[model samples]
Target: MTLDRSRWQPRTTTFIVLMAAANALLYHAPLFSFAADHLEVGSFSGILTLVTALVALFSSTALLLSLLALVSHRLLKPICMVLAITSSIAVYFVATYQVVLDRTMMGNVQNTNLAESLELFHPKLLVYLALLGLLPAGLLAGVRVEKSPRLRVAAMAASVLVLTVTWGWMASGTWGWIDKNAKRLGGLVMPWSYVMNTVRSAAPKLWQSDVQILLPEAAFTDDEKSVVLLVIGESARAQNFSLYGYERPTNPQLEKAGAEALQSTMASSTYTTASVRCILSHVDSSSEFSTRYEPLPSYLQRHGVDVIWRSKNTGEPPIQVQTYETARELARDCPGPERDYDEVVLTGLEERIRSSSSQKILVVLHQAGSHGPSYSTKYPIHFEVFRQVCESVELGTCSEEELYNAYDNTILYTDQILSRTIDVLKRIPAASPLLIYISDHGESLGEYGLYLHGAPWMIAPDVQKAVPFIVWMSEEFTERRNVHPAQLQAQTAHSQRDIFHTILGALSIQSEVYEEEYDIFNESFSNR
Candidate 1:
């Protein structure tokens, strides 16, 4: 008993070191894999290089927290407690889902309201949070550590000073190389990646003005009855869609519905918020733009088009429009689950379409299609054609086959929702209704050991860039816009940038802001 107690060790520093080691080993297998795959240790001299490269994976966070622990004896316990909870939650999610906690995802988490965030919680998550965070935090609560505050503060300062001096000296010659790689290294560290990312992501939005650019007056060219429905799909890659030639019947409904499968269409960015904004903005893909910038919706509304943005996606808000409906808000009137699926956006939409006697109308339905790591839940039970799905948020437990099945099912579900949307639009007799469905961006399903979307646009994979862009316009609508389906289909390459101008051209809404070069249908329309 005495030997066991002695071996167990009562030191807080020792416990922290052991915990850090365990966390690094268990939750950071991806970091080890990355280092091992990339490192070229040809000789003894290269060993130090490899170790130095992997320091962020194993020792960086540990060293930082250890020094911080010495700051104040009074503050140490609470700091450690908070770190324990956050680390557990962070590590569990990243390891299980095989996701990188980047700035975009952190922003999404921060921007999500309480009701939307609540959707992430389940019994499985509760269990993980308890075991990893609450359990460890509870253990720390019972432990008592004595320290001299003045002496500890001095020690912490000394430790930081030494670390800074040594780091600068060692990194001086290779400072540029180190600086370039620091961001990647930070992303590899367990818990800190998510913890710091969450803080950083929220930082931008806090100071950012919600005041969108409100335009004065927008006028239609003629009294043409047209209603353009622009549906934005989320996290749906073109590779998985059968319409793009995948073997699976993922897009059976859309294929039968005669939706024009755009060839070689790509997204502006690999994320929802960025891609959606870019698609809506007048700026071309060649030009750079910030996500906070809003123009498209406001432009349409100002130019006298009845514009409305309805969404179920997190972090996606209306662009300078009063007529915006969230899933929860729609659910109160639509009569379904608070946030069931993409179809929820369709609820009460037909009525809105019928009521609107406007010459030109634009409705943007933002679907939560194939958004991970809960793909199975996005679709109804009937649409679960692809069986043996990975239902758990911890996708690591599921096989690659299961993950594909789950994701594919969501795609199939998206197919149904889109087809149904077209059916609803068909009811509009007077208006030349057309439904343009395009995904914001694509997703990675265990590709190169990466899962989900939001890789940096500069280094993003084709799966993250290649998106589905489909056009389902009625025969009357096709004639009204002077669109040659053959020419539209023959055109090989396309992008999200074309969307802003194409809509303006299609509706014959002439504005100085509309660039003909960016409009795909401009060439087809000889009238303009």
Candidate 2:
């Protein structure tokens, strides 16, 4: 579509200048700050590096905005104004906060409930909007950008080529190899960071839509009354727990409650949804993303076993489980604020237990376990065993000791939640109950200057990959499944794949999909 360029008002050109100035100011300071703060450089080299980064960032931004201006022609002002405001706001906070905006964080943003998102907004955010967005947007209001269409097109093309070449040349002259590639870190440079992330997140959803999973019929051998619970922990690392001999009494509640911690178990990934999806499915860990999976809960439900998936966490990708409730849903159905406590999943537990008339029951609690930045919020006030905790979202701003203090408190709170869950199980009259606890992935806690999980597994520290897997069962459950306590203690190495067959073996579920070799309990029983 061709655009008419007939208006030649002086305000039009002035509006464009104001908009361009606003754009440069909004992003320029942060680009300089990020380079000065993060990159290592000598005085002579540092100035050159910072200059190059700023030039590349500004020229690329100008190139894109100029092209949008030329193409939209008449519509450019309104569209560009909106984009400018949005970009300014995004860049301001991300640059001010010093955090990377990536796809995983955007997935979290997409899935977060309004109540949770509201917690993020404060008076400071409004100030940012006024300074970054409103000021420029006000200048852009009455101006119409239409006139000299041919000249505008030629100028835009020339600017794009010149800016593209200039950015490339500036990027090439950095002193070291790391500095040469430092421009890639420009992805963290605000509006573009989020814009790129949004594209990446959307691409995966489109690609994965065609995944089709077909499963054979499943069956169960019944008679023994039983209940099985799988607790999916969040951001917990095995090395921190006393159960793994960390020196800190992080597992005091679990130890006192006599929960058996499986000392050596590593998660396949370091992100929540990815790890949980793998553990709860039949897909191999190596090809978890590539292969389609029959949802574990749905598969169990079809076999006449009851299954319920309840969570207090957010950002779950679509799963096949029909019996699913997030913390928001649980809070609405029951009574409570939607806080980070994992106990929300236990709301109306007695009724749920009674409602399931089936002999076999599986209830999964997806916990907001030890999730970070504001780790103190994850637990009640009493759980603060470690002193002077780091309570800010900017984890890098805090001392390492303070960060650990806040983190350990969450683990302590998790131990409390787990203990309470076991107490809930003990109340049932006829059911032999069992609880299996494992974290979806571990956390970084300021290791190697990395503050969170989701680093590619190969380069990630063991603290990010190693997870705690624990189990507790009533005496009846132990006897029924032939679980020799001695044998469980002796078993050290295990994969997440062990969960499927272990649950089946425990329930005496007769199915072709069940692998006896994966069931640790089956080995002890076979020898007996």
Candidate 3:
């Protein structure tokens, strides 16, 4: 076989330059600030960046090599052109996947279908299509270069230089990387530390000790039957939910259950740590809940209602706030057992209901509603109705279909749990008053090529903040509690900022710190 030096020359040079620039741009995109934050542009981050560039180059080159083998030299010109164009598409989609879908898979997207997954390809598909039509055509037209070695050297240098400059920008705060590169950079090494730091830093004000605790005055009389159930969901984005009209049947159960569900469209937070603290405490999502501030538990305790927090999703010791301890004392035996299984907690709470009758009960069920990587872990074996089931814990190894199957399974299972809880609330001997379900923050499932949740507020979509709020009250309890159905309907379109005060108002605890402006029941509260 005669070696076609001319053909190889053009192909190799094109591969070198195109791969280098694409690799450089992808690695150094503004999305990798988190990776740069911990590693900076020092020897370590530099080496990592170099490794990433090299891997990208090898991967792209490997594709080129395969193309060379598959096609003959006679058609080498068109083959290289096709490979170059496809490579560009691959680069964009992969970059978009890394930036968007990959990140979401790490966090949420508990359940998705083919149609749902197709929704994820939108922005990236358009971007890559545009690139394929324009950039590759221009590059192919400028072929016929004999200087392959020179191009290789230039490409390598440019990639390294891009890496160096990206590191510099990340360290200087001129760019943000957590939005794009947090899962890869942060999850790989620092894991919890990286996530915690980003969540904590997301609200710098929560670090302060001078924060104030706002408690709403309870409206219930001492003689009235009062019960408040705060069910906190995990990684439940409002947009994907049918309750929020995602055009899919994702939240069909909630929609059909006849429960009052408030779909907040504008709420935005990416992770549970930051968002839960904000919602559970009297603090606003715009601020952090620090130790300096007395959270809802303290206020509830002062008002003489039993404040019990049964948690499953939050860590052993709740991060970002110390107030978890106050409720912990009341809930030592409330959540059932130490099992990672959420159903155990639910079952245990059910047992508690059967065993004792606390006059005023504030039950906080910390949901494992859609915690990610292995969405199957969130539910038990019975909820495997979805066709594709992913039982693997190794996230990277799982197929996209398997992942979607597992995640949506979790969502489906969560729906069961929600229904059961509603059934329990309705069967509360016609005594217990109200049950409310709300998530701390929402999750991002493969949207815009972005995968997980916890992207910065500026970059995070409505999925993270738009949470589901389901309220169920017995007819007697609703009428006795003076909650007008019309009012509850109106409030369904309201924000979660009303929860703190609404709970207090329902409990009827008197507190001077309670601001009607911040209360959910307060008509003026929605204005903010």
Best prediction by TM-score: 1
lDDT, candidate 2, residue 358? 83
**What is the C-alpha lDDT profile of model 1 across 212-285, one tens digit per residue?**
64433445678878888998998999999898899999988888988888888888877776677777877754
Over the stretch 1-528, how does candidate 2's per-residue lDDT look in tens digits? 644343435333344444554566675565565566656656766767766655556555655556665665577677666766777667654543433556655555565566556545545667767877777676666455545454655575577568757766766657464454344364455456677787886677786755546567766677777888888899999988888888889988789878888757889776776677677766556784424656567677777777878988764445555378877677766555524367778887657877888888888888888876567788878788899998776677789899999999889888888888888888887788888988988988877666666655555678889899888978888777667678888776876777777777777687777777777677732211
lDDT of 3 by residue, 1-528 (tens): 854445534545455456445543533343344344445567764555545534444444434433443343344345545544544544443344443323333233333334324434545455665665456656555555443344454455456456655655555442243335444543322112223444554444455545454444444356565667788777766655556555546655765676676645345356665466566555565653343356666566555556666665552212222223223343454454324455544655555654544566676778767766457767767677665765543344556677677777776766777777777766666455577877777765555435556665666667666777767766776666556656656653556566776787667665665566655545555543
TM-score-sorted candidate list, best first: 1, 2, 3
Structural similarity to truth (TM-score) of each candidate: 0.82, 0.80, 0.58
Candidates' RMSD to native: 4.7, 5.4, 14.6
Clashing pairs in 2: none
User: How many collisions between residues are there in candidate 3?
Assistant: 26
Candidate number with the higher TM-score (1 or 2): 1
Select the stronger candidate by lDDT from 1 and 2: 1
The C-alpha lDDT values of all candidates are 0.73, 0.71, 0.55
- Give lDDT: candidate 2, residue 497: 70
Candidate 2 lDDT score at position 203:
72
* Model 2: worst 10 consecutive residues (lDDT sum): 4-13
